[model samples]
Target: MSTVIELAPGVRAGFTGRDGGVSREPYATLNLGGHVGDDPEAVAENRRRAARGFGLDPRDVVWMNQVHGADAVTVTGSGPAGDVDAVVTTVPGLALAVLVADCLPVLVADAEAGVVGAAHSGRPGMAAGVVASLVAEMERHGARPERCAALLGPVVCGRCYEVPEELQEEVARSVPEARCTTDAGTPGVDIRAGVTAQLKRLGVTNVTHDARCTRESTDLFSYRRDATTGRFAGYIWKA
Candidate 1:
């Protein structure tokens, strides 16, 4: 079964794991990132497979160029949304995707308004407000946060996301809910907690989360666990 959540009527959102693709080892079999040194042809084919698996045409999905920033881009067509961490769309049937390894992938939708958005929230992006930008964009299209169904996909949990005290403090200063103590008693950042708090603060009431930690799950890709690794994707679409 897919890990994708059915956010609302006619709207579906999900995250992918490493299982089916053509990229060589490290990125072997199912790596979807085109800029991660994976074979371009292999990545293209993998993307097509992912799209088809979701009942969407390869050309019907909009991918993003995420730089761990807070930029949110709106889309009405199936093309790359450049240098953005989030992508929002009001067009039914158009899918928005965000690639992540250890970072959190957020998918949200208001099916009644035909608005859906996906965001890539890493420690920096979370502190910078990527999810907030997505919600604002969705709101512009008539989707209220109170009516949106949201899902936070697999992420590097705090227990495995140890960081320097300074770095952790920096992130926590911007998003207090993200700070945590690792299992080893080191400083950590809870990307999922920070994002969930952000969603709640935005008034999004129906938030759900996939409890899997990318760093801990062998099935999912994790850059923290494997520096050079494949990237899985999170997808959102309206039917």
Candidate 2:
């Protein structure tokens, strides 16, 4: 069975790990990212398995062409939801997925409203307010931010995600919660923390997280730790 993290009721949202897949090393096992040089067939099969984990067909899941920006799109059917970093949908059985390695994959849902969303929040995406944009898109679909719950998936932690001082400062300017010092006492950013803060700022108070740092966890795929590695996914759908 595929490992899944529990979220709120009436909705299914979870993250996939680097297991139960058919790819070889580097992209070993469950690599869901098609743009990461993994064999297309292997990636396809991995995605199929992921969908099955949620009791949905592979063709019913909508994946995004993430560009590390704040673009959010509403998914109306099963297919690619254009070049956006986040996708929200109210359609039952239509799962929305976001791919990530070191970056954060955020899943949000308002079970009562039957609206669900998934976002890819990297340094650039967070600084650009991707989470807030996602909540707004969810609201457009009748989801209330106050009633929404968010889940932050596995990602590189602040201690492991060292960045240049200037870049860190640039991101921190917009997301003050992102500012931090690395384990080595150099500059870094805890994007998950920032994302959580952003979610609350947008009135999404119920939030959960997978504290597993991708760079530190062998079960996860981290691009910063392994540049040639594959990517995992965060998925959300209404039951």
Candidate 3:
């Protein structure tokens, strides 16, 4: 299932949970990523179900290769957008989808400009400035940072995101807000905090996030918790 919100009068955005699909076993249900070893037919059917849930045709949804890099691209149509972490579009009725298990799925929309963008930011992608890349693409399409609203959600939270101190320091060197100490006193990285800080610094103050931690929530998928699990997605479009 999905929980949706209107970013603006005509723009819609939502994140999906790990339910309502035909995948079996570890994937269980609602596994949308095609390259994740789930049955290809199951992945395709799940994607179609997700698109239809948003009243979109399966062929009209735009997806990405998602290498967890700092690259973002602009797309005018559906299908695989590119080997990028984010996809931005000004085309109405074109939905941008980002798949993530523990990583952050960030959705951006500038209702006034009719532009929407989606990014998949893991700790690496977050430190690498993928969100910045997304905002930059949105700006290129007549969207002003201050006029954009962003949604971050269903991620692996700070408490469960323990990391090596050196790696944590590495990420902190770039996005200080990501540095965290877990309840157990180990270094951790909070992707949401880091992303929110990045967005605010870039003049995007309108932000909303889900407090649910994928690792902690059974309703969502978590790679850290289940090594070979399914991936849910966040989608944005103008309807």
Candidate 4:
């Protein structure tokens, strides 16, 4: 069975590990993203299995093009939502999914409002305010930030994500909490920390983070660690 993380009652939210599917080595077993050059059939079957983990049909899940921007679209149906990094929904049984490697996959839910959202927050998306936009979209669907709880999924931690000084400075300008140093003392951005701060600023205080770093954990996919590899998913849905 696929490993699942429970977030709230009437809401299912969790990250997928890299296992239990039909893809080959690089995309190897359980690659849920179609854009990563994995066989379309393998990706489809993987998705079907993922949905089954939550007791829903594969068609019940909604995915996005994930352009690494701040667009959070409200989805009512299960299909591609175009070039957006985030998706939100109040529809029960319809899952919202975000594909990620080193980037953070954020899941949010206001169970009482029957709304949930998922976002792909990479360096660019974080700078573009993806998490904040997601919160706003959730609110638009009647989800109050103070009542909403967020899950910051596994990602490349600051200690492993080395970047140039200028890029770090640029992102940190808008998200100060993102500024950090790598293990080798090089500049880096702690995206999960920054996202957590942003969520709190938006009034989403009930936040939980999966502290495991994708780059450091073989259980998760990491683009920085394996450039030609698969992408895992973070999914959220209301019961």
TM-scores of all predicted structures:
0.97, 0.97, 0.98, 0.97
lDDT of 1 at 93: 83
Name the TM-score of candidate 1: 0.97
Off by over 4 Å in 3: none
lDDT of each: 0.89, 0.89, 0.91, 0.89
Best by TM-score: 3
| lDDT, candidate 4, 107-208, per-residue tens | 999988888999999999999999989999999989999998889989999999999999999999999999999999999999998999999999999999
Supply candidate 2's per-residue lDDT for 63: 87
What are the RMSDs of all candidates, in order?
1.1, 1.2, 0.8, 1.1
Task: Give the Å shift of residue 36 in candidate 2.
Answer: 1.1
lDDT of 2 by residue, 186-232 (tens): 99999998999999889999999889999999898999998999998
| 40-131 per-residue lDDT for model 1 (tens digits) | 99999999988888788889999898899999988989888898999998887899988999999999988878889999999989999999
Question: Relative to the unseen true structure, what is the Cα RMSD of model 3?
Answer: 0.8
Off by over 4 Å in 4: none
User: Any residue pairs clashing in model 1, and if so which?
Assistant: 4-14, 21-30
